[model samples]
Structures are given as C-alpha cells and as structure tokens.
Target: MTNFRIWAVGCIASFFLLGVSLAFISMNDQTQTTSGTDDLYEEIISNKAKYEKPAENAVIDKVWKKTPGIEGRAVDVQASYNKMKKDGVFNEKMLVYKRVKPDISLEDLPSSPIYRGHPDKNMVALLINVSWGEEYIPDMVKIFSKYHVKATFFIDGAFASKHKELVQMIEDEGHTIGSHGYLHKDMAQMSENQAEINMEKANEVLYALTNKKVKWLAPPSGSFTMNTVIAADKLGMETILWTVDTIDWKQPTKQVLLQRVLGKVHNGATILMHPTQVTVDSLPELIEQLKKNYRIGSVPTLLSENR
Candidate 1:
C-alpha cells in the first residue's frame, strides 16, 4: 500500500507540471498574436494621419503663378490651383512692406565675432571678403570651382580698380561681387556725404570692372552707420554681416582658424574670412568639412532661397 501511494503521488505531480506548461504556451501564443495586431493597427493609424494632414497647396499655387507664359490652362492646373487656394493660398496678404531705412551704423556691425557653432549640416552661407593677395586670385577661383561652391567676395575698390581683368574673371566665374568700400574706411565716423562718396567710388570701380551692379556691401573693420547703410542702398547696395568671423585679419594659426569656423557655423550663417595665407591653408579642409556637414551655397543663393 505504501508503494501504491508513492506511484499515485508521482502521477499527480506529473499532471500538475503538464498543466503549467500548457498554460504558459497558451499565454505566449496569445501575447504574440496581440503584439502583431497592435503593430498593424499602429501602421494604419500612421497612414491615416499622414493622409489627413494639410497639403502644401500654397507653395504649389505660387509655383504655378511664377511659371510664366503657360499656353492654355489645363484641367490639372485648375484643380491644382483651386486646391492651393483652398489650402490658405488665397488668404495670404498681398501687401508689400515699405523698404527698411538703411540706418545701420558702422558701430552696429559685428566686431568681436558671431557664431552659434561651426556648421554641422546646418550652415547656409559663406561670406567671403576678397582683398590682398591678388597673385593668388586664380588659385582661389580654382579652389572654389573644385568644390563647386560660390562665395561673395567684398573687393576693395583700390584693388578692383587696379585689377579690372581679375574683377571680370571673378564675375565670369559666377560669383557675386560686392563693395568693400574704396579705401576700407570706417563708415561710422564719416559724414553722410563722405559715406556716399566712399560708396560711389567703390561702386564706380566695381561697376566699371565687372560691368555688373554691385548689390552687396561689407564695411571695413566691420564699421558702419545709418548713413552708411543709407549710402549703400542709395547706390543700390545691401549690407551683409558675417555669422562666423575668421579673425584671419588677426593672423591666427590655421588650426585655430579652422576650429573657430568649424565649431561655430550654423544655418543662415555668414562666414567672414579674408584672403590671407592662413585662410588659404585652411581652405581645402574648410570646404571639405563644410560640404560634409552642410549645404554650401553662394550668398546670393542663400538670401534668395531663404527670403
């Protein structure tokens, strides 16, 4: 009878183990099925949300309007236009803003430096100040062309006046030319008439050299005044500021200069660099890293695209 009781106890234990195993298997199966269903439901919800979101109809409308000289309007165009108008295109204000008074002072210009961090896939523009080292102009052009990046060069009228051929070469290479002023004077201390004279002198030289209107201006020593801006604008110029100051004028080490520019560049940034040996040494690396981290575009392109 004791042996029989032992056998019966063993059978009961076996049965209990089997029951636990079966329960675990059932739970796991149910969990897997639930997880799969949840995944599918999430995908469906995401797609639904994507479809329900508003379309960029305004952008489409603008593109259509700007596309000039289309023959007859097609059904597709009308549909697209109507959809855009419904999507808040027609509701936008058509009023134009009055021109901002050109009252920025030379003192208002950035003297120390301006940089959030060197561009890392966020830098928008490079503001190049071209003066000195005219012998290296061709090499500079080649370097820019090799990297397929265009830069704005603030040419000193004195330099530009002497190197009309080089000035034309700069323009022929599809780069924007701007006035660095006739003699690189501080615009803040100058009278309004003097400022105007300075700008006119630079404009005359640049215009004569490149046969292109000088539309941008960068003050020497980053100095300027309300009168300066007014003078520039009166002569059809726009004031530009640097987001990254190279301090190449200070003759910093190439590594140090590279670090400063690489560490502080960001989108909508304007880099201030001079045509110096240190800058020349850093150019290859700067261009490579900038291309890797951000989209390198000409200053004019950046302004036009952003504006």
Candidate 2:
C-alpha cells in the first residue's frame, strides 16, 4: 500500500510540471507572433501607405474627421484656426507638403514642348493671380515687358470676363494663362455639386476668352479638396500651388514683400503674388536679386520627373 501511494504522488507531480511547461511554450509562441505583426504594420504605414494620395471620398472624410499622422495634425491646426480663410481639405491649394522628400527642382520643371530645344538656363516662371481691379493691367504688362520676362497669370473667370482686353493682353505678351476659379469661392465650404460648378464655369470662360485649353489651376486662398482635384483633372487642368507666398495682398510694403519672396523662393518654386502695385513695384529688384543669387525655372520645367 505505501509503494502504490508513492507512485500515485509522483505521477501527479510529473503531470503538473508538464502542464506548466506547455503553457509557457504556448505563451512564448504568441508573443513572437504579436511582435512580428506589429513590425509588418509599421512597415506598411511608413513605406507603402504614406505615398498613396487619398481618394476623393477619403479626402472629404479626412476633412470631416482627421488624418492619422503629423500631416493631418498640421492641417487640423490650420483649418481650425483659419476657418474664415477657407477649407483645407479640398481643391489643389496644397501643391506640396514641406515634410515630403525630393521636392521639385528647376531641372525637373516641365517646359513648353515647343521651347524644349531653346532652354533658358536661369529662367524662372512668375505666376501672378489677377483678382482685383483692371487699372493695374497696363502697369503689369509694362513692368513685365520692361524686365523682358514672361510670367503666367491666373485670372478669375468673373474678372476675366469683365476685362476681356486685359486677359487678351496677358496672352498676347507670350505668357502662360491659367484659371483661378469663377468667383473666388472657397472650395472647402462648397458641396460637391458647387465645386463642380465653380470649376466648369471657370474653364468655360477661360476658353472663351483666351482660346487656350486651360491646363493649370490655382485655388483662391490656398484651399482645396480632393473633389477640387478631380474637377480640375476632369477639365484637363493640372493644379499648381505656390511654394513662395509674398502675401502682397496683405498690403505689405514692397520691401517686406521682397524679403518674403527672397526668403522662400527655391528651385522649382511657383511663387504666388497678387498683381497689386506693391508686387509690380517690387518685381524688378526682386528679379534682379534672384537672377544674381539662384537659377530661376518655369513651373512645367520644375515638375519634370526626369531630373
């Protein structure tokens, strides 16, 4: 009887030890699997998912909600603070993000196919947004011609219609023409239908006035949505935003404007400024300084992928 009891006690102890060993092995396997899965998730987020441009629905959803990272964080802060300025989620207001790598280079900017052979080594494209009175048109043309430089003008459709001759003058000077929308409406507030309307109307009037297929667009006040992008794409227009904003519209002095432009202008930079008197007054000096310091390149040429 004593021997049988000992055997039974030994067997029970052995089973308990085996059970603990199995449990530990299972837990270790699970821990490894969890670690591997986390690593894979991070790889996807950083490598593949980061470059995918948001779809139309995704853009609107992000605007209403918020994107998941630092980019979204910046947009959220700006949108909340600048509610009166315009919506941040739509249109093509964001031409480039600062955090993105390998930005546009003068070597990369697309040139007019016709001008491909006659490349200007130090020519930069100037883009002026014309949304104000027409009294400055003559002065604009005169100043640009005086510098022997041709700058692109993005005109509001309503303004263009009223000043047909001025719009023609810009085109006649051998400068590029782009659309700035019909009424200067902020794209973030418009419903999808309204966004389409704004885009289509601008395209219509632009073609009517210039007889040129509008190939580019700039949203008023640097606001855009994915819908705005789609609309522009549908109209065969590529959206271009400014890398340098002179904020001449704020009535800054020509010196301040010049400082802003000089500080921000870079390779493949599409600088934005209104065709206000301040900008006109500042251009000659700014152009002279830029020519002396850096190579100026056109937008199309700046966006070339080959470089």
List TM-score per model, in order. 0.62, 0.58
User: Candidate 2 on 1-307: residue-level lDDT in tens?
Assistant: 9999999999999999999999999999989866755554444334433433321111111121211111111123233223322332222233222232233322232221111111112334577888785787688788778867667788899998889999988888877888889889897677657777897898788889778888878878868876666666666666666657888888899889999988866544567878778877888898788878555444454443222
Q: Which ten residues in a row have the lowest lDDT in candidate 1?
A: 65-74
lDDT of each: 0.66, 0.63
lDDT of 1 by residue, 1-307 (tens): 9999999999999999999999999999999866755554444334333223121111112211110011111123233333443333321132112222223322233222222222222446766676577877777788888888888888989988778888888899998888898777888899878988988898888888777888878888778766776777667566766667889879999899999988987765678887777887888899998887687766665544121
How much is the lDDT of residue 252 in candidate 1? 96
lDDT of 1 at 228: 74
Query: lDDT: which candidate is best?
Result: 1
TM-score of 2: 0.58
Cα RMSD (Å) per model?
19.3, 18.5
